[model samples]
Target: MPSESPCSGHADVEGKVGPESSGGPPTTLHSAPQNSPAMAQLLPSDVKMLLLMSRDPGRYSTVTRRLWGHIFDSLVVGSLERMALGVSQLMRPQALGPVIRATAMLYFHLCPRCTVQHYEAALDTFWRPPVKPPTLVFYSYDDPLCDTAHLQELLASWQQAGMPVWAQAWETSRHAAHLRQHPLEYRHALITFLGRLGLVAPTARL
Candidate 1:
């Protein structure tokens, strides 16, 4: 339950392998069975926590990593209003600083361990070449928590491995705040990318 950064794009619940992403509109699916075998393997609890954290890092107490993990378990299963509060609080600097600091510490330390073992094990094996469903990676050069160079390296590796991926980089935008800073562009890019993949309806804007 360590405080996590805005990179909720990757879900590491229990450090277990879950599902492989696919180019399908999630809303259109009625159940897990419609997804690929790998996608269907995703843990419901983990996915819930991931979605919450991704949409809003403020959803849980990010001052401590362990507390964040617990929050992920509890709040994710909590009511909808609680989720809304989390996103709303993100605009308050006083409430966000501690969480951001904690997240930085977590990533600084976790990166090394993950690089030596996880990079070779999980990402390389589980998500092999020609990544299924394709991928759209969003990043910003101004993101404080993430290193652009390192992220580029990862993306390079993915592309070199023949994984199907599309990357978008912004000149300036806070970590995970792209959606807020440039709502129109963000939504357009997302819709366009997914639409191209046939995952989104032609008229969809979100």
Candidate 2:
């Protein structure tokens, strides 16, 4: 079967669209997706390979939970409340500042009860083991959004489960922007992976 890379996120799997090259036999290059692990959960049966770039696995690893929890809290509680809390903290006396600010930040923005149920439900649906396929991951240690340690752990789990997984990590780069930051290395990694899968000509150059 012809290989396919289905990129997904907020849109359902059936709605995913891949851009194809114009001059040659149709060749799909890329698509946008919100989360890699979540997308893997919904991959079409015919998809023989997966490529993930700078996305969380949607599992509640310690770091994943903390990062996503903060995001959910911010969305649910709103920015005005956060801003007010910040301003109020600055107005308070300096002697009690650190303790008061920490308390206020937690109270105003890190309250899990407000979003825990929804978060759990989402994770439950998105955290399933990926269907058997060779997987490639691109990530950076310095990305503030997606934790590198979490990816390492997740990749290890996948490998232990006997999944074929390959990863490339950089010390510094913008999230989802590795290609722009390290073009030759990124292209080499991608082409090398696809070539190994026999999805592209072994000598093909992007």
Q: Which stretches of candidate 2 lie over 4 Å from their true place?
A: 1-12, 17-127
Largest TM-score belongs to which candidate? 2
Error of 1 at 118 (Å): 8.8
Looking at model 2, report the run of 10 residues with the lowest lDDT sum.
68-77
lDDT for each residue of candidate 2 in 57-107, tens digit (9 for 90 to 100): 322122222211000000111132333343344344766756655664564
- Lowest summed lDDT window (length 10), candidate 1: 68-77
How much lDDT does each candidate structure score? 0.40, 0.42
In order of listing, the candidates' clash counts read: 4, 0
lDDT of 1 at 7: 34
User: Candidate 1, which segments miss by more than 4 Å at Cα?
Assistant: 1-131
lDDT leader:
2
Error of 1 at 153 (Å): 1.4
Q: Tens digits of per-residue lDDT for model 1 on 1-206?
A: 44433332244442322222212223211111111111112223334333333434443323112221110000111112322233333335656756644553444356644222322323233233211234566667654434457556766776777656666668976544566777887777677666766666979965
